[model samples]
Target: MQDKPENLSREYILPDGRSVTVGDQLFRAPEALFAPREVEAQGPGVVGMVLRSLARCSSRIQLDILRNVVLSGGSTLFQGFKERLLKDLQAAIPSIAPVKIFSPENRILTAFRNMWITREDYYEVGEHKVKDI
Candidate 1:
């Protein structure tokens, strides 16, 4: 017999022999994050939040912010999250020259990566202050 093909679908039968399928489960939670239509969960979605943030910033740096967008965090690891966000953002701000989104492979360390100072950078650490040497 030929080798068995791998089960590629997100659904499967339970050990009890009941058919357990993904159905709408895959998109349910994430859909709420992008388009929260339920009145009980009324709040801004991810795209809405990002747009709001950009709106608060001065117009001068908006393009820069949009062009160099970096998305870190566990939620961003979800499939197609970045692509969806990019599409939404591009639609929302068509005037921006370009919208770039970066999601690092090691998302858990993304936040900490920028918190350290490299030895190559000159720095004088004084009491209650830090200054470049």
Candidate 2:
């Protein structure tokens, strides 16, 4: 988890009027990225949720109902993570269709990069050169 870039991206103007670069901000993870506070997902803790989601899946269809999952931040580095998640999710959403976790690196940052780009293109207020930011 530490190896992953904090921002792996840069160029977002903060509310403080300073530009945040990818490399500098890559690891500056915010709380909201982990899970939404309004929704309680503390089932048996994180492991339990993994198990529950896995049980819902099956081998007969190899479905992928759940897709576009991006795992990042500190929690992604726990022991037996990838395999455990795959095994459990496979069980939980067996009939859901194709379940996929899109990245092994800074997935969250990648999304944020896109967001920054969109802000630049759409609002004309997000232009940022990593060096300048």
Candidate 3:
């Protein structure tokens, strides 16, 4: 018989046969919006929208660990992005600590950055407080 192809959908049936979905996850990152500037223009007010969506997400997620949300990738390159995103998420969801957006000065070497993080211990320690974290 030919090899069967696995379904690529986000939804799936678990061992007990109940269907599970990753659920309606909403990203507060401006990049997720087509016209991100619109939200940015309004500033922290948009966090209300994002928080409402997140609250409705399926409870299957372990929220304790979920509080520390990280945003990587090219699209998060807006100026003052991390500060803005955190302010909004915090205002709307008081329980959610903050949103951390990682931005490298040189966007071209994201892959290299990932490799560097993996081998971070091999590199010499620096006085940078962020690096200490």
Best by the TM-score measure = 1
The local lDDT score (0 to 100) that residue 7 gets in candidate 2 is 33
C-alpha TM-score for every candidate: 0.65, 0.34, 0.34
Candidate 2 deviant stretches above 4 angstroms: 1-42, 47-65, 107-133
Could you give candidate 2's per-residue lDDT for residues 19-95 as a string of tens digits? 86556333333322233342443335443554456567784432333454556655665434555565656565546
Residue 18's lDDT in candidate 3: 98
Clashes of 2: 32
Tens digits of lDDT, candidate 3, 18-92: 997643232334444433465555432345555565677776653642465555555555545567777666555
**Local distance difference test, candidate 3:** 0.52
Model 1 alpha-carbon drift over 4 Å, by segment: 1-21, 38-40, 109-133
- For candidate 2, report its TM-score: 0.34
lDDT score, residue 75, model 1? Answer: 76
lDDT per model vs. reference: 0.76, 0.50, 0.52
TM-score of 1: 0.65
Q: lDDT at 19 for candidate 2?
A: 84
List runs of model 3 lying over 4 Å from the truth: 1-53, 60-62, 95-133
